[model samples]
Target: MTDNIDIDRSLGFTIAARNARGRLVRLGPVLESIISAHAYPPAIEKLLAEALVLTALLGATLKDDSGQMTLQAQTEGGPIDLLVCDYRGGELRGYIKFDAERLAEMPVNPTLFALFGKGYLAITFDQVATGERYQGIVPLEGATLADAAESYFAQSEQIPSLIRIGVTRDEHGCVAGGLMLQHLAEGEEGRDRIHTRLDHPEWEHVAILGSTIKIEELAQRDLPLETIVWRLFNEETEVRLLGGASLTKGCRCDVVHIRDVLSKFPAEERANMADDTGKIGVDCAFCSRIFAIPVAELENAGETTK
Candidate 1:
């Protein structure tokens, strides 16, 4: 099964930045491996994997304890309504809500934004084992999801950042790959250096090289990091790899959590749920698992402690 594939060697990136150290980041062997279990449509899977990689890339930026990080995009005029994912400990779980039928007829150009008209993007950070949370919402200003995310960084952090994302499949038709690039925070001096580097003809050469990276080879788990680096940035001076983070597919679902949701119903509503059969159906949206919650069992269970 594809789930058995080791993502440790599978999902990763090799970075090359002038005047900056580069590193290989691996999101464990199981992150994408688990995500691949779901049989998502081609376009949806590509988008999902791109978002999944962002979680890993941004997760590496978290300075606090390992916690839950979520990315969401909502659009009104799009073929799709929203795309969201929650990441923690290198595992991610989420889905996209869209009209699959509508998208099949949609043109590939102008891409996702053409479908979603007006909406907002939001990111939330929740501390693991702690109730603390922080969320920021930004208007969907850019034509791309990555553009929306970059806007969030500028508005919330007041730091100039850029993110580039590419998602595509291989000839073999396996869910292939994605890439992210961001400008590190720096003062005026650092910014000057960055501008000089960007102006260099050689840097443009590297940009072309970076663009040529194939999505198929990126999915190969057995390939060495150096091989990827060389393929993308061969003969480029001062190439280096800084570091990387690993990821997997995970969901925050549990029996207790489901019960808690049921408890949100008033006592009267809970009573209304009672049928002669004494069973109420509770389904998980992500996994589509149905739990036949028993009224009698719930009554005996008492109030759930938050």
Candidate 2:
């Protein structure tokens, strides 16, 4: 990669900045590891990619020490019933629950609404220090994940927002990226009139700029952050780069963590969890990794907890 391309090892940028138009914008790239973790088809992969970028953008807005940001969807009867992804400390992981039999019958390229039918999208941020979590939920109204998120901000936060995410898969695998622009209320006067529209003209102008973004452009794997920013807002005054962060796929699931959770259960409960083969097997829904614990191991774990 050229010097212009710092080529973030994790494959994304992080920040919260205002452009010359006085709009807040955030850029983020989705890591391929998060997409390749599952052997999902291109269609599903596309949606997953979009969700990942949206997750990263929202994750970047979180406080430095916040626990994590989780983006989730619940589709009652569609092919995909559940979608959950979490981002924390510049790392993210997620999984999808879909009907294999039904999925085979789905179109090679299905629309988000078709894939999800009637459902709900939710974004949550966990505040570890205060043991409090803030969340926003919106119906799955639009045809894209970005719409769902934009709706969350508009309705829940009462902030007008625009978000765009793009996904591309080649022989090398998949790469996804996205950007978001939000209009913030200024000062005490602007804050009091939270409903008041500030810089409405600039908001529309920037929204037009945001709408012009092509999914392919956002999908650039080697494109420098500077180039993308300049290309989008070169017409406006000086655009600044507040800061950037990396995106990585990290799994916190482990044998010890699983064992510790199971240890809390009474011996009877633990026994019930064992298979006919007398092994307690657990599967991580996120990474889809399975772990089997012998009965002795479970007993020992329980003793330690006691």
Candidate 3:
């Protein structure tokens, strides 16, 4: 983990001249930990990796420290039925549910449409402090997950945006990196409402520069994110680097929590849940860990809660 200190972090930057802001995210061991939890196929592993990167990039934008951002892609008649990933603070977790037979029929490398025929990408933000929640949905009709995100901003938020994600795996493990750029011109109060003008010259100029980023540059572990940002916008007048946050593989599955949840069920139901050993096994899909709770303890669970 010490070697991955430089990786698994998200950095924020702003282009003053272009009136735009962007984020760079790179995942190494953190990504490997998440993918390794399950024996996912190559295609699923790659897709999950990309989703995690997208989650990190978007989740880092939360203003509240306790806020959470969740991204879900749901399909009806495709190989993958559901893809869910969420981020809170700097921690991220995600999983995929798919039909094995459908996935097996896919090619070595399946396209987004092939994996999820007619799906929708939904991004949700939950603010813990304010108890406020917001959601945006867009059709998943692009070649890449980044394209779906771009559509979300274009149709839902009406912000001219560009996103790129890259994932690569080898003998070692999987690593992913992503970039997000948005045009938010500075206004007297704060950011201006430039979404109405999608053809704005400033946004176009920045988008053109952002599109030059290659998959190799984004996924390369040796290439520093700062260098990538510099190479893209160095010619501009000012590129302000903001504070960054470290990310981790976040799967919050606690024995106590699981026990408490089980306690909510009637005593008869709890009894029925336990096996011959008198323990109920609870499995966490995120981390793929199982926790066994003794039924005897749960008998008094409701009393203790009161």
Candidate 4:
């Protein structure tokens, strides 16, 4: 648990012998930043933390570095209505929208169903380089977010996958971590392809090994990610580690950019947005920040641009 041991990063690895791949992510300050942006309750904080970790794990697998990965949970008849998180180029940001009164009525620790009564989880991948986007949606039916993610891979992608996420908060701050493993069976072209072999022996063995990871271990900041991977698959013949990626709190909110977009609106629309002080305020939910732009500025800018 050295102080300099890559606290906020994700490592990719493969067990060559088992035809499996995995990603391990640990968050320290990065999680703290995102959580601190809003004064979320303990339960909501923990849930958002898990979502961010899951986003990082899946985002790291993108073939293009410039691509983006977004995970959103939308529900009806639940305490939590919406939870959104996204990752792009090793940057992560997420927030949750929950009903305070409803959350207060739940038990000390509410179940997934209690928080999100009838929800669907959506995972979207956007490849900026090729302008291609793919998305998968699945009903949120599990005890934890990890279970829902595993369901997404199994149902939508038809891939054998395992995921574990953990979040712990104390007087110091918040820490979160996650691990995801997928069995990629060999194809006829000598490359990995999605195969419908949930009962395959190799996948079963690898999944069993992956399941041994406890939530406590995933949330342990002192334990190095590399050590965790080794402890799980040390018996494997070949475990190749890939390049690791660093993660940070990435809220893409720009005042200039936002203001410019506002300037494009019609003069009457801009006038209706102004407050008593003749300033229009734009709120960004992701970072919980407000941008104040003068109405005169937008009107003048709109006239010139139009």
Prediction RMSDs, each to the true structure: 5.2, 3.6, 2.0, 2.1
CA shift at 247, candidate 1, in angstroms?
2.0
- Cα deviation of 263, candidate 3, in Å: 1.7
For 1-306, candidate 4 gives per-residue lDDT tens digits of: 348365789999999778789999999989998889899988899899999999999999988989999999999889998999999999999999889999999988889999999999999999999999999999999999999999999888778899999899756589989999998766525533454374356888899999999988988878888889999999999899996888988999997798899888877888899999999999989889899999898777777875
What ranking of all candidate models by TM-score puts the best one first? 4, 3, 2, 1
Q: In angstroms, how far off is 240's CA in candidate 3?
A: 0.3
Question: What is the clash count of model 2?
Answer: 1
Give all candidates' CA lDDT scores: 0.59, 0.71, 0.90, 0.89
Give lDDT tens digits, candidate 2, residues 1-306: 233242222222322233222222222233566655678877777787777777777887776645799999998668998999888887778888888788888888877888898999999999787888898989988879988888898888877778887777655556666778776554425354345356444566667777887877776766765667677777765565666666667678888788778777888988898998878888877777789987778787667767
Ten-residue region with minimum lDDT total, candidate 4: 187-196
Tens digit per residue, CA lDDT, model 1, 1-306:
344233442233333344222233333334445445566666676676666666655665555547878888888877778888777776667677788788878765546566566888888888766778889899878766767776886677544444444444443243333444433323435354335444443434444555576655556544555676777667665555544444545665688777767777776788888677887787655554677888766766665433
| Total backbone collisions, model 3 | 0
> For model 2, what is the alpha-carbon lDDT of residue 164?
80
Mark the regions of model 1 whose C-alpha exceeds 4 Å error after superposition. Answer: 1-40, 104-110, 127-144, 147-174, 185-209, 233-244, 260-267, 274-276, 303-306
Off by over 4 Å in 4: 188-199, 303-306
Checking candidate 4 for backbone clashes, the offending pairs are none
Query: Where does the lowest 10-residue lDDT sum fall in candidate 3?
Result: 188-197
TM-score of 3: 0.94
Error of 1 at 195 (Å): 9.5
lDDT (Cα, tens digit) per residue for candidate 3, span 173-267: 78889999998745624544643364357878899999999988888887788999999998999999997799998899998889889998998
Model 2 spans > 4 angstroms off: 1-30, 188-199, 303-306
Instruction: Indicate the residue-level lDDT of 5 in model 4.
Output: 66
